[model samples]
Target: MTAGTKPVGTKTADAVVIGGGIMGASAAHFLARRGFGRVVLLEKGRLAGVSTGHSAAIVRTYYSNSITLELAKRALHMFENDRDLLGGDCGFRPIGFLLLIGERLRAAGEHILESERRHGLHVERLAVENVAELAPPLSLDGVSYGILEPRSGYADPTRTTENLVAAARPWGLEPRAGVAATGIRLHGNQAVAVETEDGTISTNVVVNAAGPWAGQVGAWLGLRYSLRWSRESDLLVEKPADFGELPVVSDPGLRVYLRPCGEDRIIAGLGAPKDIEPVDPDDCDPGLDPEMRERIERPLFERLPALSRARHLGGYASLYTITDDWHPIVGPEPGLEGYYAFFGGSGHGFKLGPPIGEALADVICGETPEIDLAPFRPGRFIDGEPLTSAWGEGNRG
Candidate 1:
């Protein structure tokens, strides 16, 4: 063992969690709380130092499916009272999320409203005039309507993840950082051990919360996943005082969104194009492309004209493991018993982490999840059924 590292012994645990992002860290915390002792959390890099650190951290319940809406609602509740739920403040801000729709996405907005109602999530479809009322400076000349998720907002992903990690520490769960899992050792169709760069760990139940590297981890256990990777092109602009009060805004037609950070900075991201390369989750290069900036700035300038004077503080990239369906693949992989995988989050993993972590802990402990996970199973693809995209015509524009 190096320094304070736990010595390698034939230590057996009820569970071993891989990847210390929000997903893994939350999973470990929930597992320990649910009476699972000897839980171990392993991370290849520093905890919350990967995609979790680079996340835009927006939380919204706007969706065209009941499941996603419920997931978001539950997570929103947790984030709102994180001090009680996770034992500390998670720095949550309820700035609300405004989805501006064009004529093309009106139907999608309607569908999402129906689903939101079924899940008891309170949202409103605002008229163009009412949208202008929410943000006086926004130009609604070409906009159709707005889907206002009143209870939704944003948080600091890094701070939330670290807070969760600190909470897990007192629960008797040992978290090992800077340990990378290289492969898995199997015996007769069962995963017996996890091979890491530093050492080997013996465990039967492994939660592969590896985020972008989830596919590679699956392959180690002899399973195939049709997952692709992509990079999120984000820009953090330091806005003048006048432009800082806007709520988290999404213009689906323009394929871009912006959320306020602190009092003077805002984080922004452009929607993924069909032709963009599936990025390596571990390696991200953030650069400014003139065309991309032009496309991103069009709607931004129209909505918040004063932002034209904002200085670009450059950006960072986040790796997304995506499935053909935009919804994530959660639960145990098909043909791989005693192993669980959580990957293909696309970009929604951070907001979904808390609730999903609790559900995952319930699943591992042989309890029914608070939310039905059948829709998010990893085996959905084999049956030629994939979760349809919930983003409507509004987003398509």
Candidate 2:
């Protein structure tokens, strides 16, 4: 079931999932794994060919909320045991995750540490001296402290999505790459079939995980999702031979995050809480903007001075489908029977996707999930229950 092998012609299925990013791929995989029968995943492009592919792919459990913390914990387990749980290697790197706290964010950082400690997650509070020992390259000038997640690091985003789809192939999961879902057919408020460019798929259950296009997909059903789009960018710099290994680092003072891409490259991106550059998903530029280099590298250079001599290995931009609350909208829609909304990763979708998708399958099958997803329901925004974070409005959730 290689990508773009063929179109999925008209057929009947137990469930049809829209979008082939990590969310859709993971949902389709779990549904099929649960024996839901004849699950189909639709993608307008190849799997992980959009935002997921361009993700920083940081996998850490430093969340302020219980639900996200739990999901992130489970996601770490899945990536760690990818062969048994995810059906293949997901390129997980266990170099650890470090969050640098400045004097201004000290209180918020303490709150997050307390929350993680109370939830039984492995975390360490590091002083500036200890932080220097862990990451020698980091300059902790304005930093007050640091929180280290010893078991967290990152994984390959593209490989993860592809492996999920490949793993579910034997379980009756049909992945249709290059096939766009144009509309959803309903009967008396229940989804009956999904209309696509190649054909149609008749199914009782439909999951909208359509990333940036989720708004348009919901519009087909007369449902409106308040989603905004931003052009997020990341840059890669060639690592110097003498530069030693480094862990995934998030510096709040600089508003940037950096992680090792491979043995010879470092990937850096602007952190959340910055001004949003609104963009249309379809017409946005894929190449990184010229001005972004200074924004991303200035902080990166401050943290790792050795990179000053490193070569610019180019970069690219991608879309971040953001919700007003900066958290994802998941779970079943109240009025839309058999239809669920699973888009809006905001900024941290890569690590949470598989675990959330697994739990979503459990909910769809009428079984209690390991982690409760009620906090992420689609109606939370309307019901005035938007999840808040210690970091205020950002992807720090």
Candidate 3:
């Protein structure tokens, strides 16, 4: 594995995960817990070193799709009881989640509320008064209605990834940090090995959970995984005295989303009518710019007028791995026996990772998955079955 000294000894494993972010960590965690022997997780850097570490980490359950909604519900369950499942704390803050839309989408809002109710998500339809009652600092100008999930909130992303890995340590989880996957070694239409920077692992299955770098990894196996990278930025400001405790709020009318960062701050980001702001995931400015901050703060100020007194401390940007359909590319790749494409979180992945990993691990371990993942198969795009959402916004899906 040194200079041209031959690859590190051919170590065999049941599965090789090529990223240590939340998705890869969760996948490896679940795979090991599902009894996959010798599960190896390869990370170029430390766990949650990239996007996961910078995630806003909002845990919301309202989604236009049933699969994502179900997974989100399950994720909430795990977050609420991490001690039982993950055996640790994720620092989940259940301050609730609110989604506000313009007057034009009132019908769509009600439809979504009914749809979510039918999907087992007990979300409440809130009028403007109710919205003000929840977050008193908000000015409901140009707002039509709101959807509230009382149990929804945010969590610590890095801790959740770490705890998931920790819980699976007793189940043969082999986490190889600082080892990057160079490529994939295929054998007759099947992924049989994972090529690393210093070694090659002989494995029947390889998960492309490389986050923003997943597109590059997918190309090694001749797989055309349609993925895009967006530089997602968020800023945290000092909580003004007048700004009361606010829930995670999504104001589609103003194209902004914000949540209480902690006791004394609020984190804000852009919402609908998004600017793609594509960038090279490996090399991009991580600092938030004034222009971007203005885009995030304008809508924020429009909704929460009282926050004008808050001071913008600082913020950073990270990559969002988006797919063609915005939904994650999961399950097996067509014509490939053992390769699984599981990246492209599209900014909403932080909360969805655990449930997705659980189901995908079930697939890899040949067990009955609690939820159906066929809609998320890599071949869905090619098979003309791309998933859709009422919002039709990339991340909202």
Query: Residue pairs in steric clash, candidate 2?
Result: none
Q: What does candidate 3's lDDT look like per residue over 105-200, in tens digits?
A: 776677778877887877998888988888788888888778999999999999988998888889999888899999887667878788888777
TM-score of each: 0.92, 0.96, 0.95
Worst 10 residues of 3 by lDDT: 1-10
Model 1 lDDT on a 0 to 1 scale: 0.77
Best by TM-score: 2
**Highest lDDT against the true fold, candidate:** 2
- Residue pairs with backbone overlap in model 3: none
Q: What tens-digit string does per-residue lDDT give for candidate 2 at 266-304?
A: 999988565688999999899988898888988889888
Q: What is the C-alpha lDDT of each candidate?
A: 0.77, 0.90, 0.85
TM-score, structure 2 vs. true: 0.96
Collision count for each candidate, in order: 4, 0, 0
Query: In model 1, which regions exceed 4 Å deviation?
Result: 1-8, 272-277, 287-291, 392-397
* Tens digits of per-residue lDDT for model 1, 126-191: 999988888776767668999898878898888898888788777767888988888776665666
Mark the 10 consecutive residues where model 2 has the least summed lDDT. 1-10
